[model samples]
Target: MSRKTFIKGTLILTLAGVLTKIFGFGCRIFLSRSIGAAGMGLYQLIMPVTAVCYAIGIAGPEVCVSRFCAAYAASRDHLRARHTAVFCFGMSMILCIICTVLSYMGADIIAGYIFHNPHVAPLIRISVFSVPFACIHCLVCAYYISKERTVIPAVSQIFEQAVRLGAIYIIVHIAHNKGEEITAAVGVAGLVCGEIAAALLCAAIVLTGRRKNIRTTRHPGIEVKQIIKTSIPVSLNRLALHGMQSLEAALIPLMLTVYGYSAQHSVAIFGILTGMAMPVILFPSTLTGSVAQMLLPSVAKEQSSSDKLIKSSRMALVFSLAFGFICIIGYTTAGAVIMAYVFDEPKLSGYIRIMAWLCPFIFINTTYKSMLHALGQAGRVLLNSMLSELITIICIVFLIPRMGIYAYLLGLLASQAANSALSICAFTRTVSRITTHKPLRS
Candidate 1:
């Protein structure tokens, strides 16, 4: 893995990510228009549960597979990589089942208590079906990524988005022609269908293209205890981060309702903030995400050489900062126009501007977290994420009641900033320790 190869891999993955983001955002716009603001609100409202479940089922194991498989491949242990993939897939399936059951049973409580909308329970349950499919797709994609084969995942992403968008269009049109309430539920159905398609497509790609020479190790002499120990922290970190994010989704809307906003207004604001504004603000982050995913394994495989790790980490950080700044400026200048043109709502311009401030912090935080995960510092990531979320939640609790939607955005910005600062400090220290010794000879 020379720097040239690394750059080449990064470029392919980045291009893929950009394509995925474009398709995804396009889907968002179409869905928002199809469902209207209230429908979009209902659709967006249940997603926190979706995000948390998917993260719990997939995130840590996928990351672990990516990092470990890359290292194993680098060491010429293809058999180990295969075994690890098997173990990961198996584990993900089990988690998916558990999540499915829990989500179904707890949907009522989540809707009534968490979101303050008993009507949202059915939507949450329906959306939960996507969890296993998403988890499996992520796990398979991780293996391909570990092999530095970006094309498959890239193609799968496009396919997934196409399927999702197409389904949403047809379903929403039919449902809207009937009534708004049905349209909202139909939108959730579209999500479930899209996830199913994505999972099947990814599975087909992996099965069809996986090399025959890569043999699975029979009873690989690895300790399950060690694997679990290594994986738990990463899992818990993802769980905390995503859990908090989900909680925020539920809380923000509830707070808005308490502040005298109508249900429709609360939903509309949430949709605009999460679906419209956040996407625009975070568009520049796709580059860092692609690079970080690639860099994680690259860093782990080169862990013996601190210089290499630090060099890669610094390069990624610099790129993220530069990209984030560009996004901030671009969104600041053109965000309103884009919102007006896309959503036919110029009133959203303020929210868009405020949300754009989150770009730099979010990008930096993501890059830093990736670096820590690469270095097997999942506990640190967890602690930092929990602290940031706690701070943000406390702020939101105090501010949202008094200040309204703006307070929610402020809390988000503050949390991301805190996370970014902590990640930078931790990543700096780790890189310093790694680079203190001379680079190992290739």
Candidate 2:
């Protein structure tokens, strides 16, 4: 693609992502008001399981499809690109079904035993239905992304958020009027509905577009084995990363309880930090995240070209750092005021400040991880992720017990920093190796 087209695509996607995140954050604000801290806590506790399921079932395969499709298209192998998409979609469907079953069956154990909140089980089950929807939505979005078509996915995201927020308002209102306090569960149900709607919308868009570009070939070969080979390492990396994150979520309450806080307090604290503070602090990074998603295909297409790869990587890094810095400054200056006024929780300002410190690292890590996926260095990514998680677990195990909730946050910040460093190092080495063999001539 030309530079102009790429810039235009990036801008469109970035704007869409920013708008979607804004809506999502606004939804959270309304949810917090409707459900209160304790209810939000229940909502947050059930999320780690859902997040892990999503990571394992959808995220990895989606990226693999995006990367392979982009590379195949660049090589003028349209049939291969379509075949890869079909294979990835199939694998993602199988994974999603398995994960959904496990999620439904394990909801009670996760709620009662892990989080010590049995009331969250129903909410967990409701969220399970979203897995298949999310898997399909992500794969379709990846196909669009690989085709250098950003508008469809961007529009789909906006539509999805509209459905989600609208459903949440209606469901929560109905529940409130009934004199029942199930706002959190209602919120999750809205999420499931929205994801299913989005999946259907995107599927229609993709199928319609595919029909217009149909090639009457004797055989559009499906390379199922190659797709799985590329997907497995990426899948395992996502699994480990999400597994560690989930472990942190499940352990926080237990860790706090061991350090002399009640289950309610632990849940409330965890909810505010994860659902509220982290989202608020990282809101500004949505642009970078969106850009990184677009950048992956561009990078993969230009992987053998050192100058182009370096230029794209450096541009993405610069953008991520600049955005992260702005967020840090804004959040650091206005965090307390926003927390107090918006959330009505002045005490959460401290956690907000701590989490804000992690903004740059998180943003950088996200961009680098995307670039690595584009480079097909999934094994390296997995190793880096595992090492970072090990460091986090050790810190959490030792520090949370002795120093308390603050220690857990500190561990999180440290882990992100470590992961960012590792990603940067690996990315640098990969770029260097490519440049050395195939130098870009002036």
Candidate 3:
């Protein structure tokens, strides 16, 4: 691959990132308005459960597919790369099916006990349909990303968002027209619709695209060892991390009630912070996230070239940190106006103001985590992420009642900052070993 390929890949992903975020932002605004903050709260509660299912279903293969395929592709082994994609798709499908079944069956327990809201069982069950389809989408996107063929994933992202928005609008309208309330359950249905549409399109692309693109090469590929080596560590890491995050998501609302707030009030507060303020806080990451994601394959491909690795690392860090600081400034300066204008939830402005400072930490940690995965140190990446998430959970567990949701915000920044520090240190050590111990070679 050439520099132009890398640049083109980054541009395609970045453009897609920007467009997706914009469309997603619009969706959040519309959803928040249609369902109200309390409904958003219920909706937010369901997402962590969905994420947990997704982590079980597809998270391992998603990263493994990208890293291993990139390595194989860089070696000019298209057959191994394609086989890896196929294998990952299979693994993801099986896991997602298992997760869907489990989630659907356990929806009552998850809603009543885990989420602390028995009323949320319907939404949880409804959200289960998204799991398998979402898993398929994840595997498909990772394959295209590894091959530097971003156009497929980019277009599919647009398709997903469009379908999601249209479905949501229609669902909300029909419910209102029928003189029924726009419950959060209806919101979950829209989520399922979008996932189904995206998955169908992605499977079509992956199948048809492969027939046109694949050519039998000498390399038959390792059936599953390499993928398993990477996936087990990554899977465990993500499962633990996201599982904790789900706890945090659920705990925050539950703890709010302990802080003397009503359950509805607490859920609304959680919804505002997550659904409204967070979208704005993370908007600028569209650029950095694309760069970080593309960096995985690029960095993996150039592992022996210290100069290239160092240069890529520096540029990603500098750009992400600078842009992240800009996000901080933007959110601090105009967060209130933006929230009021866009979401009409000016209450979220304070949360945004508090959380905006997390941008640099979040951005830098994201970039470095990708670097770790590219360096084949996914275990280290997972360790740091789990630590970060654990700290947030600690805060949510012990402090939310005393300090309110601000504690979670503080925990978010603190955890990200710590993760960034630790990951960068690990990355620095890895690069130093690669550069000093051996001569540069392709």
lDDT values, one for every candidate: 0.80, 0.82, 0.84
Show the colliding residue pairs in model 3. Answer: none
Q: What TM-score, over all chains together, does every model reach?
A: 0.94, 0.94, 0.95
**For model 2, what is the alpha-carbon lDDT of residue 26?**
73
Q: What is the lDDT of candidate 1?
A: 0.80
* lDDT tens digits, residue span 1-442, model 1: 6788778777887787888788777777887776677777778888878888877778778887888888888988777788888888888889988999999999999988888888789999899999999987888888988988877777777777778778877876776678755456767887788789989998877777665454444656544565676678888887888888877877887788788898779888887877777777767777778777777877778877777777776777787778778777887788667875787666668888778878888888877888788787888899999999987787667888889888887778888888998988887777676667632210
Q: Tens digits of per-residue lDDT for model 3 on 61-123?
A: 998888888888878987878777888888888988888898889989988788878988888
User: Which stretch of 10 consecutive residues in model 2 shows the poorest summed lDDT?
Assistant: 433-442
Q: lDDT tens string, model 2, 283-373?
A: 7777777777777898888888878878877887787778788777877788656875787776678787777888888889888888888
Ranking by TM-score: 3, 2, 1
lDDT of 3 at 316: 75
The runs of at least 3 residues in candidate 1 whose Cα sits more than 4 Å from the true structure, single-residue gaps closed, are 176-182, 214-219, 435-442
lDDT of 1 at 323: 78
Error of 2 at 53 (Å): 1.7
Ranking by lDDT: 3, 2, 1
